[model samples]
Target: MARILIVDDAKFMRVTLSNILQKGDHEIVGEAENGTQAIQLFEELSPDLVTMDITMPEMNGLDALKAIKNKAPQAKIIMCSAMGQQKMVVEAIEAGAKDFIVKPFEESRVLEAINRVLG
Candidate 1:
């Protein structure tokens, strides 16, 4: 199982993702509320993967995705977004995000994206 970092401003979202990941037998290495924390935690935790929310307080997911990629080109990041964030999602993918999961997550899709990215 992969070691993952969950990044989201909403506590419930983080918890939900954490639960799903735990049930999938992946270990949660860290959780960050925004891009700044995500970057720091990424350095400290070096998790195998990161699930990053698109809209956040301090920094958005697309920016964080780019930042993390700058730090570690091989970093595996997956952007999480709500319904109308297609443009940002496309930008994130171009910036080096391995994949993305739409908000109000589906367990199967979440697992599928992670499996494909980590495969």
Candidate 2:
């Protein structure tokens, strides 16, 4: 099972993700409400994977993804975005996100993306 850090501005999103990941048998190492906190947690926890929200207060996911990658090129990150954020998703992929999941997430898709990235 992978150790994961979940980052989202909404508490609901974080809880939803945590439930899905825990059900998948992955360990949730930490959760962050914004990019700044995400970055700090990433350094502290060094989780196997990260689920990062794109639009967040304090720093934003794209910037956080870039920062994490800069610090650790092998860091495995997956961008989480809402509908109509395809452009941001693309940018995230280019910036080194392993994959992405749309909001209002589906359990199967979430697990699929996590497994794919972890593999």
| Best model per lDDT | 2
lDDT of 1 by residue, 47-101 (tens): 9999999999998888888999998999999999999999999999999998999
- Candidate 1 C-alpha error for residue 69, in Å: 0.3
Question: How good is model 1 by TM-score?
Answer: 0.98
TM-score of each: 0.98, 0.99
- What candidate 2 gets wrong by more than 4 Å, as runs, is none
Q: What tens digits encode model 2's per-residue C-alpha lDDT throughout 1-119?
A: 99999999999999999999999999999999999999999999999999999999889999999999999999999999999999999999999999999989999999999999999
